[model samples]
Target chain A: MTHPKRVQLLVGSPRGKRSTSTAVGSYVLNLLKQKGLEPLASLWIGHILKSPEKIDEFLKAVEAADMIILAAPLYDDCQPYIVIKAMELLAAHQREQSTTQKRHDGKLFSVIVNCAFPEEHHPETVLRIYRRFAKDMGFLWGGSLAIRAGEALQGRQGKTLDDIGSMAKKVKEALVRMADSLSKGSPSADETLSVIPESFSHGPLSFLGSFFIWLNNRGWAKQAKKRGEDVNARPYME
Target chain B: MKALILNGSLEHQTHLAAIQEILEDELSKAGWECESLILHRLKVGTCIGCFKCWDTTPGICFQDDQGREINKKAIHSNLLVFLTPLTWGGYSSELKKAIERMLGLLHPDFIKIKDSYRHRKRYDHYPSVLGIAVGREKKDSEEEEIFKTLIKRHSLNWHTPKQKAEVFLDKDDDEKIRESIKKIVVEMGVRK
Candidate 1:
């Protein structure tokens, strides 16, 4: 019998465990496990940035994996800088390994990118970045899923997939389908998936969603006030 | 108008220093004040992606590094130029690190523009943006297309009306590159 593919999930959010990226990554990992693929490892790239030892370990994991899934939150219109830094390190490792006897090749790569913006299309640039990165790294592009209004689907304080509530049904179904395809040694279609119901993406409900975001801003302002910081401070202005 | 140029080239790319000198000379000659920052030399750390800049501190990053000062310069400038070598069809990691810290320039509030959600500007104005990338020996059209598209998308998020991107081969004529930058700066309305 052929061995099950070894998959590694790298969480690229700086928020680490508390990030929505982690919640989504965990959901995917669980689905992959349910599909009978052996999960080689799951790691938080953010934590790896601080320690050289962790980075080395991350490099080792990448070398051993047959499939790699990168889940991250979009920052400043692209992958977070920490994620880019990790890619740089990975590129360096690839270069070093190329000089040796063993050549790295043909690892399947996919991305799960989420952003605070309500429109799933907001992270298209980031998804494109991932596709290009995979090509440059010699990985087979497995596809990507971009989630919009990601914070609304999972709480900021590390909510599990089970705690995702009503949306859990659609999310789970989608992941299962994706896992099934991957387990068959082929990728699911390239597409964006949102945890938000279709009704929430358009019409009156979309307007309501905007209002909630505005309310969230008010909470941020209150927190700023409590911290004795002005919400409108422009320290850089001349 | 005051312009800030971030040189994101890693050390050992001596051509970038020459590129910086030419850019500053031309911009100054065009009657624009210019500041160029060599990012790798600065002690700016990578953004940890904490939302403290938006929530707790409100436009202030907690990291207490050169990034804070760079953020200040970025918001105050009338024009911002990103100069870097393309890495995987995107800005270098050094430049991305500096750009990531710029989240403090936007408020945490979400606002819809052109039917898409984007962060509301924290300040009244943001600088126009220009991207100048030095390509590797042979041109990769796919990489160039990705770079231009990414910059245009970034311009939308920053709400900058004046956005331009230009890529030059490493072996391209120095005079031509300088002329190209001068044309962009002039068109951006930085008057003498």
Candidate 2:
């Protein structure tokens, strides 16, 4: 009997387990496990960036996996520098292995990217980057899922996905479908996934959504006030 | 007009430095003051995804590293030229790290700009951005497309009304690159 396909989940957020990336990634992992495709290893790219020595271990895990899921938060409209650095290393390793071992040509790769912006399309640019990176690395591109306003999926700090009650029923179903697609070695038909409905994310309702986001800034303003700092201070100005 | 050119090339230092010198000379001849930062020489830590710059300190990064000084320079400049080698069809990690640390330049509040939600400008003025990407060799059509799209997206997020980008192979003519830089500076309203 063929053993279950080995899968590895790489969390690429700098915030580690406390980030929205983790929330979405954890949900996918749970679904994958339920489908009997348990991940062989789960690694954080941020920790590897801090300790270069850990990269070898990451590479070993990658070599052993039949599928890899890259879950990350968009930074400045693209993949975070840490994620890029890790990709660079992986590409270099593949180059080195091309002479001695079989290339990683058929391994499946997919992405789950989240952003602070409420619009689902906010992560589109980074998703494009992922597509390019996958092609350059010779991996089979299984497609991606972009989550907008992912931070709104509320739960305890490190255990956001454990409490799925905060997520809308439709969103939960969409995520399960995405995970199902991954298990079957195909891309998810669902393009954009979000807690906010499409109607609320665009057109006139989008104005109200922007207003709510702006209103959310009041928390930052209150913190700035408590710190006795001017919220509008131009500290970098000459 | 004051300009800041950040060099983010790792292997071709001599070639990148030559390009920088030519651009600086042309801009100076055109009566524009120029400053440059070699990013690999500085100590810049990766952004840890903390929003303290937006909330706690308000426009100040928590880390007091070279990135802080670079932010100050970027704010005061009229044009920000990013010189980088295309790493995976995007800017090198060295350059991206510096850009990530400059998030303090934007406010946490969201604003609708042309039907999309983006961060409000923390300062009244933002410098026009130009990305000059150097490839080790001739890039295929796909790499070129990805590079251009990434720069455009980056420019939009920086709130620059006019976004400019130029890609050059390592063996491309230095004179042509200098001419391109001069054209952008002139178009940005700098006069000799």
Candidate 3:
């Protein structure tokens, strides 16, 4: 007669349902439901009040969940202000949990940052920010996904229907993989780091690679200008 | 020069007080007129992202609460200092709420300049920001973590001089930290 444990979802996009986070959040929730797991989706957009009552409500949901997924759009290269508030609330809630001798069992955590820039260009700065939060809040981060602008949204006719379908399928697959890891309660500490390649990566080699790309981009700009072509002739490569 | 000091730390904690005391003295030494807002003592709410400011209103949010009131002062100041405690590798909940609420000033719908224009059609002034995050002795490293977490690429790209300062109060060198705060204050004091 026991029901499956719950997974609470915090989607931080002021854009609401139209946000890429919503798309990914829905995919994750549906994936969990298919596995007979209850997914509670909480949309945290505008007006993140800090009243005790509001904090208590959010804490109750977070504590009840087996895992927490923080989905947000990258703003100013970081999460929206509400996401920061949510993390603050969670940290404080943990202190309360400690007094009651109840350790939070919420295991897996991940971030999905919908950035306007192509995922390849500069997702690192945002990823670094998210990973640091994940560590500070004591969450076992699975990974992250960065959905570039104009790739999947409405009225972006460049990507074919098949491309969109593939993207959705890949996203669904990633969510399922993450869920399976979460259910085991033995999540790895590898910190998959969600580098889309298409996104940025960690370590020294990536830094060197980035520097080279910067050099190349600068060279391209110089050559264009010398040719009397507009350096702004084309938007900077994603 | 006028400086607006905002202590966004919840409960007006000692660490923020240390920063304020040191900053005020340094700023006074440098001859800057300082106006500080100890944020936690005031009432401020999170941004609702209503977009009313951009679409319906030109430069004001519908909510004329403390956040907007503070924004008015911020506009008048030449420098803005945000002193906050690092809570879970980021700013305090109260601080984040205050920053987000300031979004009303950046509403594109409120003032639109066409791409062809080289200058702003209507200018909204934003003061230089100095973000200082202090962590407890047991969590000094966490302060840097939060600093990295909060400073985004786009923020760095902004032409304004927005700098970040951090101190692990538990293991901090008071003199060096004071000097750093002083440098910022002195610059603010001398700026136009």
Candidate 4:
């Protein structure tokens, strides 16, 4: 039997030491290793992205990888600058160079955003920012894992959220399926990725309304209230 | 309204041009003079998160990064507009790091508080935000929902001017997106 192709996972975490992002990256790396496919994982910190050269180095790594999984923590409800910046540079480079040469056609792109609170709902709106980034760069999105912030490192050291167990089996199963797809060159199994759907829609009003409901249902409404907004009277889409 | 437009696209990728044209046209029609800072052409760095501006340094972050200059412009402007592209569901890292390093606006003086959380006088009041997230979405066309949520969340952070509007351009249709921009511009009072 042929050995599966090598996979490169780029981990984007603003948190330097002892982070939930690293924990998830470790888990994915281990699972891939257990499957006997060579997986290379590296961490990219946001603060270190000082110049275009640094961003270019990251794009090079992403180009070499068969699949890229972004393991990041939700900062201020979105991916930190390092991850976003890295993706932007990569996409730009691909677009600029596509006419001259074939850009990296890395089959899959995935994100595991570890947030402080994990709901049984969809990923945050901020994650949609990355979805747009991935789509522009022409990566076949492999889906995302919005694990409860704390659960990733429950057995280890550092902060862990309460709902890790709530989505463990489901998350693991999803990751396994994603890994298989990466090995086989197929679309990810999680077809209901919330971000991409909103990106390509013509119905802006309907999309805006649904997103407003989704945001309110999550802790965003409370945050808005904390900042002194009557969420009920003023609907988001309005 | 004197508006400044910052395009963050790299060389040859014309997406930034599209956004600039739409935004500039709307703002100019409203009689606003607009300027742009295309960040990809600028020299900048991420915020180190060192609290030097709060204690060690007065009215300055130790690092002489581009954030200080941008912050100055933001402070001077009536309506600070950021024409940033979405990266991983957030602002570009350059913009993000630049945003974090804006703590130079905070005063050097600080006071200890009672309960637990120490409070420093917030130096810079955030400007009214009108974020436009362009690109693809999941679930066929679900990215609009995500952009809408992003806009709402971002708006919550600001002391908004009673009313605001947002445009989510996930799909790459210039004409349709142009129409959306027109609508949002009217809501923002930039177009009569």
Candidate 5:
């Protein structure tokens, strides 16, 4: 496959521009921009989905692009509702195009999925769904990268990968690598992304999971305490 | 006994509708007070990732919507049923909105289960889950596997006593759907 001249980033967070999903996706987008690509566009699905005109415009942008990079969070073990809804619309559009004897063959589809959990394994199912979408829709599979402990990045909102320093070192490197491949119009090998050398997983630091859970529990406890509510309250049973 | 059937179909398909009817009829025959909800028609809003449900009021979403009522019924029911068309090996966006809102049902704390960390359940007795996903065709086995795994992962995290995930195709007939519902009710602790 040849390199794509036009690449579009689809941000699937409900928070739109302020979301970490956008930050991560935009990081890669900036890398691609520096690689001498055309001016990039990042379409936040959350803002445009409810309006018919905006959604059509989003679809047109997608159709016009040679590649689509979907950056979304893992919700309920898979993708959020907005992402799925967007996919449903895109799938329908692709089907319509197919019926009309039109094809956007060789369009590359890639995924950057992040999860709150501190385990790389959690986002596996969502990544599989994305690969299936590409395969079924006839796009070349551009591979996927799943970020673990994405909640940790919430504190570093609005900061670029380089600005975050060590905490985001691996992620920044991964995105750069991914951008490098995309810039050459080459689909990332499925095997290359899976071997990220424990990127964002806190490799060999097993205590991070329990630490995150403890810290999460404490934060919620503090919030509940301020409102005079019990974190463990069984409201439904009573 | 009570059963809450959450129908998450975006479009009304005869096959999925037949499956819903079969499940409701079986639950009713078994002396269950069954309520089936068509999620697409509900005025439920998407979860904005605010932890208000857990941080402010434990076990209840602050958002004034049908999701709170659905979660209440789900907590009280003996069986919580999910009915949906599996999109890209997952539930439709409509059904997922309701599911995300139910996060209030789990506390922010996590407990290790089978070496994986999951949210702790907020209530004493959690209901059994039965997920039935309709696929576009029978040959879509890979997507079906992913969908079933997604349900099982949910069951593990929800700490359900019993759980089952079934995938049906558009060509699947009424009798086959009925048989599957019978198996779930009889074996998965709903018909007790």
Candidate 6:
């Protein structure tokens, strides 16, 4: 079979194109661009929810693409509702005609997930869920990349992976590695998994814990203060 | 005791509806008041990822929809029962909307639990969780394991004192389904 080349990125953050998911996903797609693959412009799940035309347009694009990359933030323990909605709709759109249970027609499915927790493993469940999605839809699993976006990016939204400077260096390398493998062929499950184990758990490296905590706490406090709201208000405790 | 069952059946498949019925009837007989929400019927808006609930106006969502109300109800309840069709081994989109908006119910600060660090609950007490993922076939696939693991993860992340997950196959008879749910209730320590 010819090498799967067409790449369509679906950013699942409600913040749309200005999200860290877009940043990370776009960086990879741009890298794939340097190769021979022609990646289509990203389609944001949150943007086309209400527009039937846009939704149809993207689903049509999915049919034409060789690979689908879902870049989403881990909300709670799973993908955001918008992304889940996209999954539901995509299932209906893609498999409407398939009579078989699993349609492995040489398509590929990969995911890029971001989480707020200091530990990168927090997105594990979401990643597994997406992998399950790949199986259910009969897409070749292209592995996943999970990052501590809120802190590593220092709560930076609307910033590209390149624009985030050194903080994004390691993640960028992993993305480049995955892109290289994808541009070659759909990775055989193990090839795309380049997890960054940046955790603040109590251990020999626990000294770095406070730094992340301080950055996150300061960012939330400053944002809350700017809006003049109590960051720690326990409304339910009353 | 009060139980909140978030019904996530997308099509109300006959077996699933029966399971929900048996769940409500059995839980009521077990000496608990049940508030079951048919999520698709409610006007729950999507969480806009606005950290306003966390940063700007803590413990509050600005949507003014059923999503906010569900969060309030969940935090106040003694038990949370996640009922879904195991979409990709996770809650359906209908059920996930409420769960996503529930971010405010968890404090953004990480609290170490066992091996990993997870966000702590904002309230003094958090309700234990029970997840029921339904499937049409009885095959034991990766989806079932993924669903179970996600629930167990939630038990830790959401700080649930007790939790259980069961996969209900469409081929399952009413008695088998009831037994599975009863096992969850017993495991959850909520069976009065």
DockQ preference between candidates 5 and 6, better one: 5
Better of 2 and 4 by lDDT: 2
Q: What lDDT does each candidate get?
A: 0.80, 0.78, 0.58, 0.55, 0.81, 0.78
Is 1 or 4 the stronger prediction by TM-score? 1
Kindly list the per-residue Cα lDDT of model 6 for residues B1-192, writing each as its tens digit: 888989876754445577788889888988999899888889888888777788877888877788877887888899998989878888888888878878888776665666566775678888888898888776667888889888997778888878888887878888988887777777677774
| Greater-DockQ candidate between 1 and 5 | 5
Docking class of 6: medium
* TM-score, A chain, model 5: 0.88
Decide which is better by TM-score, 3 or 6: 6
Kindly report which residue stretches of model 3 are placed more than 4 angstroms away from their true locations once superposed: A1-5, A14-20, A41-54, A116-126, A150-238, B107-125, B145-149, B152-154, B162-164, B170-176, B184-192
**True-vs-predicted CA distance for residue B41, candidate 5, Å:** 1.4
Q: What's the CA error at residue B25 for candidate 1, in Å?
A: 1.7
Mind giving the per-residue lDDT tens digits that candidate 6 earns over A34-69?
Answer: 988989878889987879999988788887788888
lDDT of 1: 0.80
**Candidate scoring better on lDDT of 2 and 3:** 2
Error of 6 at B100 (Å): 0.6
Question: Mind giving the per-residue lDDT tens digits that candidate 2 earns over B1-192?
Answer: 788999986644556787788778877888778998889889888889887898778888999899999999898888898888777668888788899999999988777788777888999888888887787777666666777787788788789756677777788887777777678767766653
Comparing 1 with 4 on lDDT, the higher-scoring candidate is 1
B30-144 per-residue lDDT for model 1 (tens digits):
8888999999999997777677988777788889999999999888898899998877778888899899889889877777777777778888889999888888688888878
Question: Per-residue alpha-carbon lDDT of model 1 for A189-220, expressed as tens digits?
Answer: 66666666555657868766666767877887
Which residue pairs overlap in candidate 2's backbone? none
Two-way DockQ contest, 3 vs 4, winner: 4
Once superposed on the true structure, which residue ranges of model 1 sit more than 4 Å away at CA? A1-4, A99-103
Clashes of each: 0, 0, 5, 23, 1, 0
Residue B144 shift from truth in candidate 1, angstroms = 1.2
Model 3 docking category: incorrect
Angstrom error of the Cα, residue A162, model 5: value is 3.2
